[model samples]
Target: MEALYATTTGLLAACGVYLTLRGRTFPVVVGLTLLSYSVNLFLFSMGGLAMHGNPAVVGAGTPAADPLPQALVLTAIVIGFAMTAFVVILAMRARGDLGSDHVNGNRLDVSREDGK
Candidate 1:
């Protein structure tokens, strides 16, 4: 299970990075989301798969998954949402300012860049 998770995490991350380097705003945002999901899964897996477990507050007689990773995943989730929102808003603003959704190589944005 751990190996499976690792493989999945790697594949998704690689794909996300590849897609993220594209010129379109949509694919890049989607790739970012995919990468974030992989990161979350990777972190979650670090806690180890639990079987017959209890909360850490109970100390003995029970195996418990690490709470630290869980907490981190929770925090990352919220932060990731905020990041996605910010990226999306930036995409929109770039679209409005340059009248195209492409990233660095967009015609209008490129023309503007040439002026600088």
Candidate 2:
């Protein structure tokens, strides 16, 4: 389970980084989201991967799961959502004003064509 979790997190972070390096606004936004997800997963895992554990509020003899990571992840998710929404809106506005969806307000193909 630990190996699987680590692999999944690593994959997400790798993909997120790849997409983020793209020269398009949409892909960058998606990449940022994926990166956030990876971070959330990392943060959550820091609290331990206890399965069938009791809640932190419980006074059972068994060890209880830590609630701190859970709370942090939840908060991060909310913030990530808001940030994603804002970035989307900003991208839309940039698209409208610049007449292009590229990160630099210019099409890569067009620039390449011009160089030819």
Candidate 3:
């Protein structure tokens, strides 16, 4: 289970990075979202992979799960959602104003003599 979880997290991170390096805005946004998801998974795993552990309450038993990582991941999720939304809006506005979705506001396929 641990190996599977690690592999999944690594895969997500790798894909996210690859997409982020692309030349388009949509893929960049998706990549960032994937990266955030991977980070959340990592943070959640830090609290341990207890399958049936009790919550960390006042009178919990020995196998109580740590609540800090859970809380942190929850907070991160909310923040990531908001950030993603904002980025999408910004990308849309950029596309509209620049007439292109490329990250640099210029189509790469079109050749330019000045090499801008």
Candidate 4:
């Protein structure tokens, strides 16, 4: 299970990086999201994948999963969502202002047509 989890996280991070290197805004945004997801998963896994474990508040004999990672992951998820939204909005604004979605520059046709 640990090996599988590690492999999955690595794959996600690799794919995210590959996509992030593309010359477009959308792919970069998606890549960032994927990378964030992989990080979240890794952080969550650090809390241990206990089977049939009780809550941390339980006082019984059996071990309980660590709650810190879960809480951190939850906070990360919310922050990631907000960050993604802000970045996407910024990208759209840039696209609208620049008349193109390309990260580097607008296409010749678009530039010529827009008289930019």
- Cα lDDT tens digits, model 2, 25-80, are 99999999999999999999998898888887755667898899999999999999
Cα lDDT for residue 71, candidate 1: 97
lDDT scores in order: 0.86, 0.92, 0.91, 0.89
TM-score (C-alpha) between model 2 and the true structure: 0.90
| Candidate 2 ranges beyond 4 A from true positions | 107-116
User: How badly does each model clash, as a count of residue pairs?
Assistant: 0, 0, 0, 0
Identify the candidate with maximal lDDT. Answer: 2
For candidate 3, give the lDDT of residue 57: 81
Pick out the ten consecutive residues of candidate 1 with the lowest summed lDDT.
105-114
Clashing pairs in 3: none
Give the alpha carbon lDDT tens digit for every residue of 30-88 in model 3: 99999999999999999789888877888655778889999999999999999999999
**Worst window of 10 by summed lDDT in candidate 4:** 105-114
lDDT computed for candidate 1: 0.86
Q: Which should have the higher TM-score, number 1 or number 3?
A: 3
Query: Least lDDT summed over 10 consecutive residues: which range in candidate 2?
Result: 107-116
Report residue 17 deviation for candidate 1 (angstroms).
0.7
- In model 2, state the lDDT of residue 54: 87
List the candidates' TM-scores in order: 0.82, 0.90, 0.90, 0.85
lDDT of each residue in 62-94, candidate 4, tens digit only: 678999999999999999999999999988998
